[model samples]
Target: MGDPIKKIELKDGTTRYRFVIDIGRDPATGKRRQLTKTYDTKKEARAEYAKVKHQTDEGMFVGPDKTTVSAWLDTWLKSTTVDVEKATAANYADALLPVRERLGGKRLQDVTEEDVDELVSWMLTSGRKRGGKVGSGLSVRSVQLTLGRFRSSLNVAMRRRLVVRNVAQYTQIPREARRKAAAMAALRVPWSETEVRQFLASIRGHRLHAPVLLALIGMRPAEVCGLRWSAVDLDAGTLSVELTRTLVEGEVEEKGPKSEKGKRKLPLPKPLHAALRAFKARQATEAIRAGELYERSGFVLVDELGVAWKTDRFRRAIHKLMEQAKVRKVRPYDARHACLTYLATSGVPDVIVSAWAGHADLSFTKRVYIHPNVEHLRQAADQLDELLG
Candidate 1:
C-alpha cells in the first residue's frame, strides 16, 4: 500500500489530509526523492496522488516550484516583448514598485483577488515622499494605470503557467472612486479665444514662439518638438507630422507618430506660416554668426544655441509667456484643447476636425475636444428661436 494519509487541523479550524509520494531518483545524485501534496479530504489526496503517479509514469510530471509573485514579475519585465514603448516600459516598472512592495512575497499560486483589492486601496490613499515631504494620494487615473500594469504582468505569468489565473483582473475600482476621477477630468476647461490670442501676442518675439504657435495649431508638444525643417513646406502652407520626439529614461528619442492618424499633413495657419518664415530667416542669421560652432539639427524649434528644445524647457517657457500675457496658466498641452474647441465651435464638420486633430474617431474629437462656450451656445439658441418663430 502507498503511504497512509495524515490529517492536520489548519489555523482556521479546517482539517486537511497530506500524503507523500516517491516521485523518482535524482539523476545527478542517484538518490530517491519524494514530493508531498495536501488536499481537503482523503479522497482528494488519493485522486491527486493517482494523477501524479500517472504523470510520473508518462514522464510528464514537473515538480512544484516555490516561485513568488516578485520573481515572476521580474522575469516578465525582462522577457516581455509586447510592443511597449521605452517611456511606457519605465512607467510599468515604476507602477510595479508598489505592487512588489505589497504582494511580492506571496507565492504566485497563492495570490488572491482580495490581495489585488488591497493593492488598489493602498494605491488610492498612499502618498510618495519627495524632497522631505509626502504628497497627497495618487489620482484615480494613476491608480488605474498602476493596476493595468500589474494586470499585464500577471497575464504574462499566466501565459508562462506560473499561475493558474490572473487574480488582479478580478479587482475593480469602486463606483465612488470612478465618479471622483470623472469629476476631476471635467474640471479641465479650455481657454477662451481671447485668452489664446493674448497668449500668442505675448510670446510673439520669444525664442519658443514657433513651437508654442504650432502647439496652438493642434500639434501635441512631442509632435511640435519633433517637427523637422524637412517636413515644413512654407510655399505649400503645410507640414507633415511623421515623427515624434519623446523623453525616454532621461534620453530624447525620435520615433514615428503614435498612430496612423498622427502621421497626416496639416495646413499651416497663416499666422504660424508667417512666424515660421521669420524664424527661418532668424535661424539662418544665427547659423552664419556661429560658423563652425553651430549644430545644424534641422528641427523647427530650437534654443538660442540651435539645439532642439526639451519638453520640460518648453513647458517652462509656456508658463513664463502665460505670466507675461496675464492669462490664466494652463498646461502647455492645453493649447490643443483651445485649438480643438475653436475648431468645433466654428461649425467645422466633425470629420474634418477629427482629421485635423489626428483623432482616430470623430466621437473622441466631439466628446473630448469640443467645449462650447456660453457665447456660442447663446448664438445657437438665437438661431433655434428664429427657426421656431
Candidate 2:
C-alpha cells in the first residue's frame, strides 16, 4: 500500500510551529481512522506524530470554539451593571458604541492586543462633543473612567467563564493631575458690617425684616423663608433647621436640608434674637386684638396674609433695601458669606467655623473663607515682630 498518509508536520529548528493529523487504520474492524496531535518541535513533531499514532491506537482529540468578542460584549453590558445610575449608563454606552463597529465581526479568541490598543488610540485622538462644545478631544480622566467601567463589565464576563482573561487588565490612560490652582485665587466677598447695618435699617418698616435678619444670623435663605414659628425658640434664642422650602420646577415645596449637616440647630445671633422677639411681641398684640381675622399661617417669615415668602419677593425686598440704603449691591446670600468671612478673619478655627457654614470638611471652609490680602500681610508682619525681637 502507499506509504500510509502519515502524520504531517511543519516547524523551524527546535521550535514547533504546527500540528498535523495522521491517517491510520483499525486493524480489528479493517476500517480507517484519522488522528491528530500537537508537537514541541519538528523533531518532536515526529515524536508527536508517533504519539498521535499511539492516540489513534487509543482515542483523544479536541478543537477550539469560535465566538465573536463584540457579540459577547453586548451580552456583558446588558447582564452586568445595567442597574447603574442613568447618567453612568449613558456614559458607558457612549464609550463603547464607536468601538463596537471595529470589533463586531472578530471572534473573541481572534481579538489581539493590537486591537484594544488601536481602539484606545482612536478614542484619544478623535474629537468628542461634551458640555456645549464640539471638537474637544477626550480627556484622560474621561477615557480612564469609561475604560474602568468596561473592565468591570469584562470582569463579570470572566467570572461567568465567557472569556479566558480580561484584555483591558494591562491597559491604562494617561491621567492629568487634579489641579485646584484656580481656588488659590478665589476670594470671599461678603457684605460689610456697615452695609449689613444699612440693609437692616432700610428693611425696618417691611414685614420681611425678620426673615432678612434670620439670614443675617447665617441661616440659609431657604431656611429663613421656610422657618415655622413652632420651630423658633424665642425664649432660648435658637432656630431649628429641620425643614427648608425652595422653588422646585417653579413652585415652592418643602424639602429636606441639602445635606444632613445642614439640618443643624444654629444659635441665634443677638441681633436676630432681638428682632424675632420684637416681631413675636408685635404679632401677638396684633393677633389678640384681631382674633380670628389675624391670618396665622404658622410661618415665621410671611406676607401680609401670613403666606410663605417667595424667592423673587425676597430678592426684590433686598434690592429695594439696597436701593434705599445706597449700600453696595450684593446678593442676599452675601449674608452667609459675611458670617463665615467674619469668623475666619477674626481667627476662628476652621473646624468650628466649617460647622456653622454647613461645610462637611474644614478644608472647604478654609478655601472659601481664608483669603490672603494686605491685611493678612500686615497681621503676619506685626505678629512675627515679637518673635523676631
Candidate 3:
C-alpha cells in the first residue's frame, strides 16, 4: 500500500517519473524485494507499473536471475535429453564445452553477441580441446556446432524470459575457417569404385570381411556393429536396421534408429548376403569350438568367441583391411558416403538413393552424400553434346 509513483528532479532541472512495486519476500534472507521502473513520461511509468503489478499478482513475474551460463547448460542438457537421444545429448554437450570453459561463469543474461563472436574466433584459433599443434584451433565444423548449440540454448532462455535475445543470433563462423574446412574435405575424398573393389578382393577370406562389407555397402559403423543375426533373414535376403549401438562418452550404448525412416528393411545386396551366410557358418563353427566360453551376443559382427564388436573396433578393422588392400584409408563413415555416391551415379533414382541411405530428406542425401566426380561430369557433357549435336 506504499506510494507507488514518485517524481524526481534531475540536475538539469528535468523531471522524471518512477514506479516502485514490492514483489515478494526473498526466500534467501526473508527480506522484501522491490522492482523499480523509470520512464521519461508519467504515462509510460504507469503502464509499466500496471504491467509489473499484474504479473506479480498473477504469478507470471520473471524477475532478474543470475543463473550462470555453465549452470544453465546443465539444466538445458537435462531438458535436451528428454527430447533427443542420449548420444545426441552427449554430442550437444561436446559442442557446448567451449561455451562452458570460456563463458560458463558469466551470467546467462549478460552474454552478448561480441562474447559469442569472440568465442567463435577463439575456437577457430585455439579451441582444440586435445591433440593438436600449439595455437591450432578446433575444426570449422566443430566451431559451427558449438555456435549452433549455444544459439539453441539461448532460444530456450528467451522463451523462459531469462534473456531478452539470443546473443549468438548474428554470430558467424569465420570465412577462412569455412574455406579451410572445404579445402580439407576436398583433400579427403572417399574411396573410388576401383579402390572399393580392390578392398573387397583383399578382404575376401579375412575374418572381419563381412562386417567391413556391411560398412562399404552403406551401413553406418555403429549399425554394422549393432546388427544382430536375428535382424537378418537369409531366407528372405533382407536385413532390418532397427537398432544401433553407438558410443557415448567412450562407452557403447544400445538405442533404436535415429528416425522412423532409419528403421527400414533394406534388401541385402547379393555379395553381402553371400558374405553373411559364409560368416554365419564360420561363427557356428567357432561357437562349437568355444563351447561354454562363447558370448553368443547375437550381434552379426563378432570375434572368434562370439564377442560382439563396437564401433571403434570395427573402424580399426576396416582401416587395417584398407591398408592391407593397398587402398588409402578414410574414416569408416566415408564408406557410407562412397556407397551413396555410387548408388546415385549408377542410375539409381534419387528417391531410391535417399531411402537406401535411410534419410527422409532427398536433398540432404544428395547434398551431403552424393559427390560427383570428373567422369560423372564428362558423362553429363556427353549427353548434352548428343542433345545439341
On TM-score, the candidate that comes out on top is 3
lDDT of 2: 0.67
Question: Considering lDDT, where higher is better, how would the candidates rank from best to worst?
Answer: 3, 1, 2
What tens-digit string does per-residue lDDT give for candidate 2 at 317-356?
Answer: 8778788878887677777777777777778787778888
TM-score list, all predictions = 0.83, 0.51, 0.85
Give every collision pair in model 2: none
lDDT of 1 by residue, 1-389 (tens): 54667888999999999988877776448788799989988899989988888877976565655788788788788776368788777877877877888889988778899989988887777734341336556777777887988898888766555565789887898889899888987777878998888887788887667778899988999998899999999999999998888887789988998789879999988988988999998999999898888789999888656888878788888898889889999888888988988988888888989999998988988887788879779988999999999
Superposed Cα deviation of residue 10, candidate 1 (Å): 18
lDDT of 3 at 26: 66
Q: Candidate 1 overall Cα lDDT vs. reference? A: 0.83
Write the residue-wise lDDT of candidate 3 on 60-131 in tens digits: 666778999999999888887787877787889889989999999999988888899899988888878665
